[model samples]
Target: MILVSGCTGSLGDTRTNDSTDDPTTGNPTTGNPTTVDPRACEDGTVRPGRAPLRRLTRFEYNNTVRDLFGDTTDPAFSLPSEDVGNGFGNDADTLSVSSLLAEQLSTVAEGVAQRATATPDALARLAPCASNVSPEGEEACARTIVERIAPLAYRRPLAAGEADELLALYSVGRTDASFDVGIATVIEALLQSPDFLYRVEWGTSDPEHPELRRPTGDEMATRLSYLFWGTTPDEELRMAAQAGELSTKEGVRAQAERMLEDPRARKTIRFFFDNLLPISNLADLERNAEAFPTFSRQIGALMREETQRFLEHEIFEGTGTWASVLTAPYSFMNGPLAAFYGVSGVTGDEFQQVQLDTTQRLGLLTQAGLMAGTTHSNNTNPVVRGSFVLQKLMCQKIPLPMGDILERVKPPDPYSGATARERYSQHSQDEVCRTCHQYLDPVGFTFENYDAVGLFRTTENDVTIDASGSLPGTPGTVSNATELVQKLAESEEVHDCFATRWAEYGYGLTLRGEDTCTKQAITTAFKASGYNVKQLLIELTQTDAFHYISVASQE
Candidate 1:
């Protein structure tokens, strides 16, 4: 069967007219207020949106095999890389498997299963009863193995006939082969099973709203594990689901709080920030080695690591606020990075938190990695930098420039004597280019203090750089990148945008008009929590969007 059959019943449509609540005021557009809490919908009804069936991304699949089989080969690397829709590979809409991907999945599963059951010791670990089973007890031992691994592979207790189906596969393989071969067959089948690959959520009936349904406790456990740990639910979480502890919001919150303290949560945090920013792109960052003699691909990799370390520390160990993320005056750096940034005292390759030069550096925007990633190989590009700030940081949609316009205009000349700001002044010279460049170049010019490799500079080609620029909503202008980021750290729009991004990443869907109330609830709590990064994650689990599902209409 094709992978398309895996998603047969998981399709869904969002409820558009479920609530008339004003997102800002929390009052009905045509009726009186229903409650005092501003975070609720106007009718005080929980209207959840739809969540499609999500197949495991390559990252999740690798993690699953590592956890499930204790195999560290990263077999999913053989599978196709995922489409990075909506800035994340996990977006459910783009996770459909093509025939090629299906074939790869089967191939990878066979390899993983063969490796997992390669020896008698491994088979014993897979099913403890396998080590000493007699010929008479072979079927019984196979049943034992099926009962043990199927629940984990499916991520929930098997349905009535599920174990029988898996045992049937085991029987066919064991007809002439040994028990290990039979177990291998079962492993391969489990890996390719729809229930194993897809997070299939069939919501329970909600009497208060017949149209709406809440995810079952086991399904909730699956959701939490995947979001927080990026893998299958552990035995403890599964036990909690079986015990009905995951049926309540408080229980889920308790579990999320516990999960965030794990090292696995750090990886999830890194994935989110790595995708949200341009950090991961640094691996292939092209630079003119003749000009930047000290820079190399290794340095780019370290820069990516530096940002990830800072993000993990700030969210879990530091102030854990959006303010800190944008304006923290310290960053983690090893000896090489410290020397690269002209700082001293840090030694060895072990990264440690080091204070930054406040006069020149501040937080993520001024970091060398991002600064270098956004600029050109030999010179700074204000337009690209400004577009990154506008489109990514502020969530402003900068429409694509016409193809003819792109062909006619070129980047500022790096070989010129003028500073980056002066060279880029040509963008505003053309009326057609000025339309978008006016918005882009200004924000980008603020980073003129940092050069191509993000080195602090006062002059380029013997000309004093002008690093002053204006933010869109903020008044007046900021003198440099530090001031620009400081203003952004306090912006309501930026804060709400951060919340919107997390909600989208966690729920695996892009936000739409119907998601207003859900977004408002998350934003309100985020603001209430002073934008605490960890607390914002906890708030995400408590939203209606996380707890309920709106099934597809019967057309």
Candidate 2:
């Protein structure tokens, strides 16, 4: 329910609950806060603002790929590695623009456009104009292309001359050897344009005052699509945009729900899972070969896939509560993973969750990905695992330790070694380190029974592992990975944190102090939908903040 910075926001002062700070209408003040409302503490909204204009995050590049193309290609491979501020990669303001990224984008765009033109699934949905194609026909061709892809590319249609200019580029491209090349060039240009890369907040024209501008319906649909589906608007959605059905809250809600029902809507949920469990590049993960002999590169990856299948089942196919995800008795596994997890009924490439015989295999906390990511090449870092829980799931930040983690990498004496907790406590003997590590290492020690590659282990350094730990911000102990997941599933903070993350995604940037109304609305959505990820998305995009932009930002 509370923000991680708690009171130490990177920006300015925060009023916990200011009546004037409507999350929907915004802070009634966009700039810095003046006098703090006395009512802020009781009902103060933690409205998060933009960190600063940074560069496009890796996830944004991936989402853009999935949206522009189908969910087939993965172009983030060639993109620049992200510079993370807080935890998220896509904090605009913190994001930056560079020649290197632009070059990469150019190449990616060419590849994506070529694939879009040729691929069956993608070409089937292409909106290219068969009516005209030439340097002479550039205007008509551009007009048709702009009309169809514009709503998606710019998140709104272009103005009268906008298509004309793009057509001019197409005319230039006509000098190229092929029509497909020209079209691909245009699509490539659109992807690189500031219009596509950034959240272009274009206001629509006022009917009463012809000179006034405000966002039109197509713009609203673009906002809804990116917010809910993490993609460009499909044809039906584009039709609604052209027809002016996305301007009102009711219309946005209807469209959002419809998108959720659409097969593509799952992209948003999948994105959330990907971010939460950064599995996009499993091919790169490494484990200590000798200690984790069973953890081949393939097994390292199988764990992530199992988690995905498990989540897909929980979110889309079966019960949709956070509880079911953690406490559910079932899990999916390919042959290797099933053998590792010691479960049956699961065969080859296909995965299906068969009930496990033991209660220890609760949820994500017990999962191998969570385990491996938290450990080092040959050892488990309880601090990393525990800190992840505190910072990510609980919305409580364990202050970053002052220096590099203790460089002591030697394997401990197993025959005489204490539990993982005892080994971890050695570094915290210093005063400065104890401050934060105390909070994290204790919680992380619970998964010590799982080794570097997440394979269950009876002993570490020849000593039996101890998988017992306690939660800092909660009641009861997480005796092991099983109870840890149960504790997280029941925690309101986890759900609230996830919902807030979704709100941030929906708005296409971080929700600012002015945006309490949206988070409040999101909270209502979580409660009403019984914490369904799909349902909360509809409620979020239905709000004015999802589409409405102030007049000046449009410029």
Identify the candidate with maximal lDDT. 1
> RMSD for each model, in Å, please?
7.3, 6.4
Alpha-carbon TM-score of each model against the true structure: 0.90, 0.80
Tens-place lDDT per residue, model 2, 146-236, is 5666546776656778877777666677574565555566777888888777765545655654443445676666666666566556778
Model 1: lDDT to the true structure: 0.80
Least accurate 10 contiguous residues by lDDT in model 2: 6-15
